[model samples]
Target: MADDSIRGISRRKFIAASGTAGALALAGCTQQNTGGGGGGDDNGSGNGSGGGSLSGEVIITGSSTVFPVSNEFAELFMDEHPDVNVTVDSTGSGGGFENNFCPGDSDINGASRPITDEEVENCESNDVTPVEFQVASDALTVAVNNEADWVDSMTFDELSQIWRDDGAQMWSDVRDDWPDEELELFGPASTSGTYDWFNENVIGEDYQHTAEHEPTEEDNLIVQGIQDSQYAMGYFGYAYYSENEDSVKAVEIREEEGDDPVAPSLDAASEGTYPLARPLFIYASEAAAEREEVAAFLEFYIENSGNDTVAEIGYVPAGDDVIEENMETLEEISG
Candidate 1:
């Protein structure tokens, strides 16, 4: 992301930048590095409070959605271990896994969706064994403009009609009272884990697309699209919804067996009652885990992520118990 985070511009400003940015990707978005911190003192200082370096170079690339959380973790971890270089990249979840697991490039691969059998096979082909760690829970949120007040929440069936290809593209086609205007959609590419989650839930078995909303695969773009137009609708992980709530409005989603429509939130998402709720994961290769640097960084992430790091990045913490389990596992690996 750009420094505009502090400037606070309208979605229009973002779109205008998009037009000129030529294939603006949701990759490693570097901010002004806030260097200068103490080093050498891991008396369990936790989030780099004591300021000691972790000891080597660590690279992470994956879901743009996961980047913020992992980046937040990295920033804090590096503060303590400034000597260790920790890098997080968002090349889309599937892309991250392919690059890391196939070639085994990344120490950790963050994903918005669960690992596929194919991805697992790819890892095995490279003689890499992957172990998954559940970092947090997420609700796949869909948002529309605040101006469109007729609908507050929707059934999965309704959402399906709204976005799936060959399905009704107009808002009214899904709901009788909705306007006849066609709904302009925005979302990630097919390579994204978010896309797979969306298709399985929103698009039915026969779903196929003739066209798609583009150039803005990052959730921020979806936020911009919806904020720009009342008729626009898009979906992404809930963290984006929380970060862009002022500009975008969240729609309630009805789970198949649910009694009431629920809006996405940390509480609702954690319980799995939110229709679009699911777990977020990071799959790491044994080879990567063997590296002292990779081991230290991933350990730091699991620790800090459940602590202050993830929340700062607009995400909920996976419970303390889960975090403890991860830490214990890390100690086992390093010990």
Candidate 2:
């Protein structure tokens, strides 16, 4: 069954970005899960189910940021292997790792952050080992209202000056040419994986001024906040920003000395020009991989979908060459 723990914005944003809108008929799935023991029809379809039947259910849960990518893949996979029933749950990256990655129980888990030593221990604690798969990268895009004209890109140093508590809080505070209202900040809650990434990569882990505003795990909340205010600044994974392209504007972060500050376009993000781009992932237990359903799902997922789904979801694709390489990795590992 699905969990209603997260607010609505994340779901809506995901639906918008991932082309889940195409399957609008399949929203709000609520089938209760009994620890992923169920399987599906042995003769699943598209991409050729490899002449096998998956008789059980495959439960995947993890980072909301990673959900769209995986979910899009999952949907396509299910289309390929009719017998393979798969379910994806978005309980935040941290929640999935903490609650669902029980070695003997859950099959796969996704995380927005890299696994910690403690979490590795946690995986082993329940006898479930973890394997990392770098799926795609994302950027923590800082966006503003579309009407904003005085600024274009920002530097980490400049970001720290504007966001960390000690930095002036208003758009005008950073520059005299900008408006003089107090700086308004919106961002993910402390528990979010993106939050940690933003802290370490963007603002430094020891940022001084983060306490002045709301820290929400919901990207949609941050999106709404930013959309509603002109003086506000916020960050979320690239896909969220992409989905709301009509409502928000992505700010560029200045990089090389000769290069123009670049916004988070698919081209810039894929080529690594976007400063905040990062690899996304999911960890599957060896036991999970051993299952025909799991194997077929992953095989079909990487095969039929891959980077196409990434682009469909509004984030940059991993590129056709990268997609082929990932397929090769899966074939080698699964074989």
Candidate 3:
């Protein structure tokens, strides 16, 4: 696909003015460059480290939620092997696979949720089989305005009630003692993997109820919405919440009445007590795996971008067992 990295921002001018940090920031954003055949390594030292003699580009697009983790991995990978260029685009998970998998334009697709059966069928029909890798775990988080002191925690049923189409629109409607304030809702778009996971787990069969909440493809917009109003509450991947902890308050979640509520955190999510945890994935096409650069980058990603990288990006690691299984899967794919 076309590189839509920075629209009017010239890469060279941006690099010259902002240095390496700005280049890395530009890497993770949606930008474009039309003057060149393909982008090259203008940010790293021209020396190869322990990484193999792999040269060429590894293009990854998908999941704005997973973009930070993969972008960190790409930054580190290019540091070791400057000759190998890596680009990560933050398209939503479904758009990522659809745009890059059938025609096989990308080496890897970063996803926040599992690939659907229909997506798998489409790739297979196009002669591309995807090898899946579980990279990290994320706790879908709900947050309210920092001033919303009346709510400390909520049960799954209560959350469903708040989000239901014909359900409560006032805080006092949810709880008799609470003030009668109009409830404002913000959330991710239907195309977002985070949205899918929440819809399946929290909204249940009444998925159409989400129409009441304002939806946007951008997580930052949701964050901003929550920050703007005391009555506002919204949900997105845990990473965004963690990054904006000071501006918003995270709502504790309980599966049922008797269950103790659990706060969203690395420990709670990894231990399965968070009540809204889900696995994150990256699917590599078998055709792309044939390229040495693609293979090397996948190996590096599975091996190095776990605990430290996940934590740095405000996500929970998938544990040693999952990482080991991922390594095995990557080996099988490249073999």
Candidate 4:
């Protein structure tokens, strides 16, 4: 089902930037035959009309970080195939995959991080095989308040100290000479793939954030929260930070002492020097991809979103090799 969790100005800004108008329509969809017109009538007739008009609805749900790119793609795709209705929702990547995607509730799932084994097992239990596609790359950004003058760079050990169990409660606790002001921490909800990645990479996998930390699925909230607090620190996809650059400053990170701290940037993320840089993905159920409408949408999605649209959305586009591999994967499973 298409979800209605996003709202407000942030949602409005997101939609406007993604180039869609009106609120999303979230109803259970029924397949429509495209009639005897255009391309391969895996449905009926084959009449060429260039892009070939197609019909039917495709449901896309998952990571908020991936939402902008997907929404833009959906808008463009629907423009070309006006009869084809596509719905996109920004349920956190983990929640979408764990609850919606594994049960085969959505045709395509966007993820800010790779799918987990547990999610794969759940899909298998439900008799669904998902084909994976790499659509973009993102730097998991660690950001701080623009006024947090005491901060400059942080080592992984310092980050772990601040986020791990019974984590450091004040800036001074993280370092001997830092300010003693209380450190307000914000982060993604437990259902976010960004949350999973940060915990696994920064905090210990089995460990959890301190009870005092605030979490939400909305990255805009994290941006606002950090901006409002002088001693605050939070993290989200680089897109959020980039979009709100005036309110927040990205923290340079170092794996250890003696290493040069690197900030998140498109170049650093692309070259793999940014420690938190990772690939973004989309997963499609084998059953869904077999449908002509879903297949066409998926092909169109990668062809468009994998490059320029990705950069426009404030993330790195997939490399040429990555794009080719995803195309190969789509052909292999959907064919």
Candidate no. 4 TM-score: 0.86
Steric clashes per prediction:
5, 23, 7, 0
Off by over 4 Å in 1: 1-54, 206-211, 256-258, 331-335
Assess the local accuracy of residue 262 in candidate 2 as a C-alpha lDDT between 0 and 100.
Answer: 77
The digit string of per-residue lDDT tens for model 1 on 1-335 reads 31314122322343354332121111221221111111222222243323463477777777867766676566656666778777766677888778755577777878888889998898888887777777877777888899988778888777777667777867889888989888888877776888877788667666753255653446677778888998888888776776667787888877553568788876666556677877788877767777777776666566554443344344555666777777677666655
For model 4, what is the C-alpha lDDT against the true structure?
A: 0.75
Candidate 2 structure quality by residue, lDDT tens digits, 272-308: 7778787777777766777777766665544433323
For residues 1-335, what per-residue lDDT tens digits would candidate 4 score against the true structure?
Answer: 12484411143466454334322111221122221111322221222123646788888888988887777667666656778778888889988888788998888888988888888999999998978888888888999998887788898888999998888888999888988899899988888888888888888776786657788877888888998998999999887776777789999999888899999877788778888898888999999988888888777666554343455456777665775676687788777
Pairs of residues clashing in candidate 4: none
Best by TM-score: 4
Q: Residue 93 CA error for candidate 1 (Å)?
A: 0.8
lDDT of each structure? 0.66, 0.65, 0.72, 0.75
Report the C-alpha displacement of residue 6, candidate 2, in angstroms: 8.3
**In candidate 4, which residue ranges exceed 4 Å CA deviation?**
1-52
- Ranking of predictions according to lDDT: 4, 3, 1, 2
Off by over 4 Å in 2: 1-48, 102-105, 165-167, 205-209, 256-259, 319-335
